[model samples]
Target: MPAPELAAVPGSQDPAPAETGTSRPTATSTGAPGGDAPLGFTGAGTGEVSSGSPDAAAVEEPAAPAEEAPPSTQDSPVGSEPAEGAPATREEVPTAAPTAPAATPAEPTATPAEPAGSAATTSEAAAPAESTAPADSAAPTDRAEPTDGAPSSEAAAPGEAAAPGEAAAASEAAAPTDGAAPTESPTPTPGPRPAPSPSPRPRPTPRRQVPTPAAVAPAAAAPSVVAPVDAHDAAEAAAWGRVDDDGTVYVREATGERVVGQYTGADTEEALGFYVRRFLDIQAQLALFEARLAQITPKEIDQTLATLTEALAEPAVVGNVDGLRERLEKLRSAAGERRKQAAAEREAARAQAVAERTVIVEKAEQIAEQDPARTQWKQSGQRLRDLLDEWKTAQRTGPRLDRPTEDKLWKRFSHARTAFDRHRRQYFSELDATQDQVKAAKEKLIARAESLSTSTEWGRTAATYRELMDEWKAAGRASRKDDDALWARFRAAQQKFFDARSAQNAEIDAEYGENLKAKLALLEQAEAILPVTDIKAAKAALRPIQDKWDEAGKVPRADVQRVEGRMRAVEQAVRDAEQAAWKRSNPETKARAEGAAAQLESAIAQLEEDLAKARNGGDAKQIADAEAALEARRTWLDQVQRAVHE
Candidate 1:
């Protein structure tokens, strides 16, 4: 049974060859079709045009026929190609027929397929065998099976080239179709379509590692139709590159297509990956740069940006170069902002550092201004050093200070330190001189005290020594070394004086002990003269005793009162005896008694003679006068006699 056939619609000229110079894009194969390989081009565009301008190719060209006619409807399977010699009606033609390549019969030799992807593409290229004829064959039905179902445009008539847009339109039209059942051609045997060059399975584009800017979202990964890749991503990757089976890698840019590098002995996918990795490296560097925007210095960022810019300008890899350039531009703009921010922060930090350093300097000056005499030397010195240390720390770790300001602060601090040092030295020197003078004065006082210590003039010498001690107290202190020695010498002299005075007192008391005994014995002997009967004898004994008592040496002070009291009692007794003797032996009393006795005797004789004469004459008056005189005489005489007898 001959395969089912379609009748030819006659009267149609063989379709004009696809416009000359029109190139068709073939899809780069990633792997065997079963495990998610991208389907080839489904159909052709409505018309033929050059491969250069894609926008013009998208317009509908309903009047244009298939570029290449099918096997004269005799041999073609039903619905395989349009009827021979007759323009195929739109209803009868397969949906993909519009975008099919030229089917002209005049030239049977097939043109070599163009590279897999195009410059300005919105979709994946058609598969290799899907779009291109295997070899020179007259019928569209004789082309490779399992194809994009688009007719060849590379088979266009000579001298009839269309616009560059034909390629893009044809590329879009190269979508695969479900219209015709896959059937082997029965006409001239065509060469078998070249097996799709093996290619490395493309890895899914990884998410960028850089954090998104506060104002921007993360860039999406390049869309691809490769395994484990999206259709959009596949189309995007195709726009940048297409690696050949021969290990050549090509990069397409807005500027133009160029060979970036090669990876010999490597599969198309590996080679492409090798170049793509270089592009990824650029991206990684960009991500790292963005991440470091806040961490690194602005100058460093500028240097790194220069390096990255250079690398991106003529990179060694093949990828979405225009997109990468755009991303770099964004990074450049961000870097400029980051640089400004970093500079501002540094300036602020420097200002703070200057303020801190100024504080340290001022503190040092304050310490230096304190009075040297009252200043705590140890504590003040340590504080100054600590301030200096703080200044050094700020200098080491903080922002650099301007030279003039730093030098001015340092000069003030240094002057303060120098002033303090000079003051300390001068103060200590004067103190040393004063201490020396004090030491000398104390030595003289000690010598004077020592001289007084040995002198026997106890009362006067002790007074002199006391005066010396008072002088020592008035003397100011010396250094500890000299003051202690001076004090020891002075105290020894004072102790010596007191000890000698005590020894002299002890000797005097011993000598006075004998005197006390002698006085006591004399006192007893003198007391025996009390109650004197013979005043002369008592006086004689008392006088010898009194003399002996006087001869006795000074008595002890405790016995002086007792001995003197006994001597006083003996003297009083002798005095009473002397007064009694003087009363008995009075001379005036004897004289008066003798004279009265003589006179009375004479008178009594005279009176008696007179009385006899008168009695004879009988003269009574005369007798009476004589008689009265004789009586008075007798009384005077009797009294005198009594005195002599007593």
Candidate 2:
């Protein structure tokens, strides 16, 4: 049906020859109805249809008159050539008629046939064009189906094209419409229109090129359309990416229509595990550093920091950079506090140590100035040791201190202790030597005194022994053991000498007893002569007794006084008798002699002359004879004096 209608339009004549740009005769050109008849047909091509000959034109002319004039009522479809005479025919047709379905013969080619019933009313007014043609021909068949019941559907096609030409067209038509039914078949084929299905055939249409900046502008300008990524997840992925074998994810600019980025979660579990382990490792390292910090003195801070830095650089730990950064902040805060405290502690410890050391040093100087042998270095050492013990114990239990300062103080304390010990030892050693000297001197004295104890030279030797005892008393004390023994020995020697002298004194007393008895008898004879009457006779008699008394050996001290008193009485009697006789023999001379002898006669006349003569002659018998003669002379002289005086 489509082939003959295409043949009926003069513009569709000789379709093959028109495609080839060659002229042919119209009568035999079966693709179109007339060749050069100029029937005002507006369709795809006029030049091709015009190439047919006159015979072909005569046979197809009547059919052309039927369809050509009707189709000429509508304007040309887009990209179709203008009919040579159709613009004038298009003007002759009333505007309302061209809009009517019957006015458009080419409606079947432009619209689908699904609603063919509506075309009957519109085509009735224009029924002559189809009636003049044969009922069974392809042209009438083509027109009858699309126009009979679906005339409104046919008019809808040309109405769409005319609507755009209207200046006052509805504003609703300007807006984009997604579900509007096809106003007319896409201006090419007229058969059953395929449903406007979404094509799966990949369009080879080249995409319109856009600049990178322009492509990115839409996303940048409309940030709300794009969701934000999780920061924590990003950080975790980044950290894991550092140590994991999988690559990392990061945002980049969009290129053309594609957004740029990476997918670090290629090995999600392993990368996450690596990140977790690195975090734990960082924590462990931080803990170790903290523990070490507790032990560190102020001086060791640099070394500790260096060690921590070295540990942090390990590949195992590098993955935990964020954790490291967090820990570093904490460590820095703690370190600052620790440093402040450590500095304060160090200052306190230094001050205390300096004061204590000053005291110790002063004590040491004092000890050094004193005599090592006599000084109380042991007591000083004990005090210093106690102080040192206190310091050491404080270091163990007290607040933290500087390590270097602690070491220096300990060294000084140890040195001081050594000095104290050295001095103490030297003192005791010298004291031992002094004691030995004293012991030796005492031992020598003891030996000398022990040897002298046996000497017995009475007076001279005893005097020498007394002198030795005095020397011993004056001597210094010996060592305790020797002093006691040596003193005992010296005392024993002196006691021995004194005991012998006492014995000799007793013997000398016994011999003096005999001498005392003989002297007593001689004294009795002298006392008998004291009462004699003659003085001259007594004088002569007492002279011999005095000599006897002198010649007698020493008497006992107890008897000597009594013996001398008796002799004095006897001598006085003899002198008195002699004085009486001389008075008788020479009266004038006797009176002068008596006066001169008054004070002397009593004591002088008591001496017994004979006994005294016997003592003087050293003859015991002679002393006895003199005593008898003196007694007789005293008797005779007393008689003569008495006779003369009468």
Number of the top-ranking candidate, with lDDT as the measure: 1
Residues 537-640, model 1: lDDT tens digits: 88778777777777876765556687777777778777867876675566787777888888889878888998889888898998888788788889889988
Per-residue CA lDDT of candidate 2, range 414-491, in tens? Answer: 666677677777876766676677667666766776676666677886877777767765665666777787777777
In angstroms, the error of model 1 at 545 is: 26
TM-score, every prediction: 0.42, 0.29
User: In terms of TM-score, which candidate is strongest?
Assistant: 1
Candidate 2, poorest ten consecutive residues by summed lDDT: 122-131
RMSD of each: 29.4, 42.1
Whole-structure CA lDDT of model 1: 0.50
Cα lDDT, model 1, residue 577 = 71
Off by over 4 Å in 2: 1-266, 287-292, 297-304, 307-320, 354-360, 369-473, 478-492, 495-646
Error of 2 at 241 (Å): 6.4
